[model samples]
Target: MPTKTKSKIKITNKKVVQKKNLKEEVDVRTPDGGGWLYSDIVKDHFFNPRNFMQYGEEEKFKFNGIGRVGSPACGDEMVLWVQIDPKTEKISQCRWRTFGCGSAIASTSALSEMIVENSGMKIDEALKLKPQNILERLGGLPNRKVHCSVLGDKALQSAINDFFRNTAQHSRVQTAGAKVIDKELNVTDHDIEEAVLEGAQNLEDLQHKLKVGVFNKEVIPQLEDLLRFYNEKYYG
Candidate 1:
């Protein structure tokens, strides 16, 4: 009878799984078991959030531009409001509200500070601010939490777009690679693609998701065609 040979198991340092509770919320700044997930600045910002909106204070803020993103149903939502100096066109003041996790609060808090820093950032300069810049200033978030850092800039850009539209400065609106589909609402193919991917399947569903053709009934056909193309490409 042949002797049975046992297979040897090999383990590498990088593949080592730390024995710890995955359910517990570890300190992001200090490593508990999962290692440092956030930097010192992120910790400070999360603990002492700045320019955050308090309850019943929504009406008190006098803002010229407003931007909102995310949804509470998805477990994260952020709203950013800005006051632009008429003379300087700089972000005079910025306030925010976030209904999400620690990272979300910290990112928005950091953004508010950066915006109002140096006597407020210029609108054009502020619009150029990207997620990478915010992440770099915070000393970088963990790979999984990186998406949280994007919320601040997205909201800020949306607010800027609102400001441009409100001031009749349509030339300043940054489409971010989106081609305009409806001139009235500034609805773009990118917006429609995003809405469809987010689960808006029909004309009514798309309207509910993006308000794309709500006002301009004439654009319904074009909107529908794009929606169908995307749905087929992605889902079919």
Candidate 2:
């Protein structure tokens, strides 16, 4: 009954407005959508690593102590050399080479800087340098890459131990987590731990990476226990 009061509505045609094309700037360094953004310090160190030992330069350094860790077969290796001032008992120079990811390179570079800066850090103080300290100096590494940072400090500790041993300070030499697992290849429990951290999930994987327990059947039980322990400790 109210249809008698219906009113006419005006219809208007509106122009469709198109959005302007926006251009986004992309960084060529990170082509994969900015994957894993490293801090500027990390990037700088990675691009131009400090105290890196060039090939054939090791003979020229005259370092007082040398330490090596990890393995090329396991995908990461670090060799650290330290020159200590006997009078001051401070680390005068630190040089290192690593076969690893950018995080590893950057972390070791930062560590060498920390050791040699301010006329160098004391051997005791350098021994106190932990992975956390290196990470703090590095501005931090990614979670998965944190393991890579460990190699630098471990190698540094090994170098420090070598220094102590060289100085006939056997009492100060620390062999805390190292136990020979493969006498033939001189592989140790630490090596097995490193292999585990590098993604070796089982005995076969460990064997592939470190050749541990391959010929040394007697060490298999110990290797199994170590593998389980490291797996739980790192990836549990």
Predicted model with the maximum TM-score: 1
List TM-scores for all candidates, in order. Answer: 0.68, 0.63
> How much lDDT does each candidate structure score?
0.79, 0.77
- Summarize candidate 2's per-residue lDDT along 35-102 as a digit string, tens digits: 54676788999999999988898778888887778766557788889999888999999889888888
For model 1, the local distance difference test gives 0.79
Q: How many pairs collide in each candidate, listed in order?
A: 0, 0
Task: Show model 2 residue runs off by greater than 4 Å.
Answer: 1-36, 179-236
lDDT of 1 by residue, 5-119 (tens): 7547655568665443423433455445654566678889999999998888888988888877776655678889999886799999989989888788888999999999999
Worst 10 residues of 2 by lDDT: 19-28
Regions more than 4 Å wrong, model 1: 1-36, 189-217, 222-236
Return the TM-score for candidate 1, rounded to 2 decimals. 0.68
